[model samples]
Target: MRISRRLRPRSLRTRLVLIATVLATSAVLVCQAAGLTVMRSWLTDQIDERLTDFRPPSPVYRDVADGNGLDHRARTDDVLPSDYRVFFYGANGRLLSESLGRSDGEPRLPHTAAALKLWNGRPTTVPAETGDGSWRVVADSGSDGMRAVVALPLDTVEGATSKLLWFSLAIGTVVAAAVMVLGSVAVRLGLRPLNRVEDTARRITHGELALSVTETSPDTEVGRLGIAFNTMLDQLRAALHRKDAFERRLRRFMADAGHELRTPLTSIQGFSELLLQQPAMAPLQRNEAHELIARNADRMSRLVDDLLMLAQIGDTPAIRRELVDLLSLAADGVTATALRHPDRDIRLVPLADEDTTPGELDVVEALGDPHQLAQVIGNLLANACTHTPSDTRIEVRVGTVRTGPRAGGTDRAGRTSAAGPMTPGIPASVIEVADDGPGLAADDAHQVFERFYRACHTGAVEAQPGSGLGLAIASTIAEAHGGRLELDTGTGEGCTFRLLVPETTAPKGHTR
Candidate 1:
């Protein structure tokens, strides 16, 4: 008990050691105590039997002996050897005769209850002790009023008992010691995984979320605890990781905003300084300064507008029970994309004009802000143009889709329109804008969509032209419109960008 309390401050090793010691000690104590009980019973039995046989002959023996002179040596001659003793007396309790031979010099009689009972009763035995240590004595009385008593020296009896006790103590001590050692080792082995969990928990505060238990022995309480603890750690690590990523993204957004504004502010300051320093400069120089100032100011205005749109994307709710023309939206995207990148070639790919082109275009429209949809289209077109070489061709494809086999399954991607995010049988449309530029690398295709990431290896990315906010803004807009943006690596050729939007079946207030 004390050992357990003291172990609290030590390592796992100490606590395990304490547990092992207790179990081993208890096991050995029980075994030893049981052994002692059995031995005591066996020793007592032997002593009782020895005393019974050594008792002197009663009247029946004297009758059988007739004239042979009934003394202890002669009475026991046919039954016991000379190392035993016998004493005889009358029923009146008067001393008769006593005989002893080869008795190891210990007292023949201890004057115990066996002697007194022999003088009174017919037969009995009792424990006796003497100067030599201890003994077992017996007494017998007969109808003829003759009594017999027997006595055995206690030196040998005590010697055997002493040896037995020592043997038991020695064996129990050895076994208990061995168990303590072996049990300590086993306990430590079983608990090593728990120690690892402790260390992992401590490491968590240091920002290492990767620590986790690998494997452990099962079927025990400790093992279950380890499993549960590991599962909790996993959840905590995931939440912490998201929190860290969110904080990092927020800081990066602030820094990018400041940097973008600095360029326009610096230009405005320079133009104002020029005006102040030389108010009468030449017309050419004056015109150049005014152009520079206006361009920088316009850039700043565009930046602020995009930032505010991003802010409102999620908060502004769209009524889903409304309809708009999907194809018209595609046309508007082409014109807007052209205006953004006037130096690039942006074209709309016309599909086979079935009756569905017009009818489906109406149904393919989704319940969302058409202005926001146009913003998404504009962002995608701008992103593609930024990563495409001058004069590179861009194709914008738009059409309606069906879920069932009648309209042919979902698409080549193995995902049917039935499983599409816009709800099955709801006649949605997809805007596929692909560019034939040096396509993005296979590894970077997915990561390039991350906020502020530029495809450095694509060789066509605008490394410094604009804020890296176009793709993120486009993605946000797509999500707000109940749609998703999917990208293809286009390693074999140019990049493929697809926007899938759900169709609404209700009415629409006029939208552009």
Candidate 2:
């Protein structure tokens, strides 16, 4: 195990090549072993055939000739070769004629007891080793009480097998080397996409999210991974963009809050200082200074209250939801605003034809926090009253919008439609407060709902003093109730603020 670990390659490509080479070598060795076994078996079979075909001289020749007869010598010479040896023995196991002349090193074959016992002309073959080399021998006995044995040397088979083994080793070595080289190249090419992914990851770590991997085929593993990675990068970039936008809004809010607070604080401080330095000033001046200081103090208090309310709204504000009558709420808002500015012309127009009377109750109901919803309406009314002139007409239209209008149309009072058609999914109760005073410019209309944002009326009449958080608060409240507040206004057409809230039916026996 330790040696294997030491030999293991560090790189994946090298490891793949090493594994391929090992498998190939093992296959080659198996095939070579099979071939060698077959070759050895065939060579042994040829030797056995030669041994089976061997014959001895007839016993009749022995009666007419001596031990060194010409016929016996001729028979032995015909059957034996230089590398083959033949021996003859009598039935009693006595010495007889033998081939393998003494001048040829006189190599003898080992006697096999089992083969020697064979008789009846049936030959038996056996393997034996002698001083010269290994050999295959066949022994048989004739009816004349003579036994003959023939042997063939096995050096040729052994030599051929040895040469084949060397040849296979050389071939296997060359093939293994080639596989290693080619396999490494293939692995490197296959893993090239992964390398690209690593490079992209490195760049992303340095905050370069713009870099993306190019996918070659969606079906491949590497291509799918690249696609998923690109999707993740897109999501991360979007999140970062949202964070940046939120940061900008936060900075702006801080600057605006500071500026708004500074105004009231400066006024309060100046007035208080004037009163302190001039203790014996005129009675009228002293009274005026006290009143101014009190007014600035109130302004500062209201500013702080608005800021705190905005902070609360920024959090998840707990809402006490109940069925609310939007039409009744609008009427209350208009009455309250009229009481504040008695000379301002404020009219309440109910879009619901059934809600014709001013005292109609629960004509348009919705589910929300009654108090917050009322506050939303009151803020819109107050904003309209404050921005418009005393004689400029202001209209409060309360209605349940089931479907949108087909085309633009004017109301009985010639006011354009402020709220468009209701959104498709949910029924909504819309309240629009439109004023005929100088409308907000295009830029101001967009920013009117921003915290502490006041429009700059260039070369026009001054707007009423305000903390500029009313519309922002109203918009937040609307959103909390799964609704939205929108604006419809152009430069010369006057401004309209529309609040749409999802409508809900009142429960049985519920009264407002």
Best by lDDT: 2
Runs of candidate 1 with Cα error greater than 4 angstroms are 1-40, 50-55, 59-132, 144-155, 171-259, 276-295, 308-362, 365-371, 381-396, 400-429, 434-468, 479-483, 487-496, 501-512
Which 10-residue span in candidate 1 carries the lowest summed lDDT?
A: 410-419
Candidate 1 lDDT over 249-336, as tens digits, reads: 8898888789888989999999989978998899999999999899888888878877876787657745343455666888888987
- Residues 69-131, candidate 2, lDDT per residue (tens digit)? 444555555544556665656555564544432223332433443435554334344444335
Reference-based lDDT, each prediction: 0.63, 0.71
Alpha-carbon shift of residue 141 in model 1 (angstroms): 3.6
TM-score of each: 0.57, 0.72
Relative to the true structure, candidate 2 reaches a TM of 0.72
TM-score winner among the candidates? 2
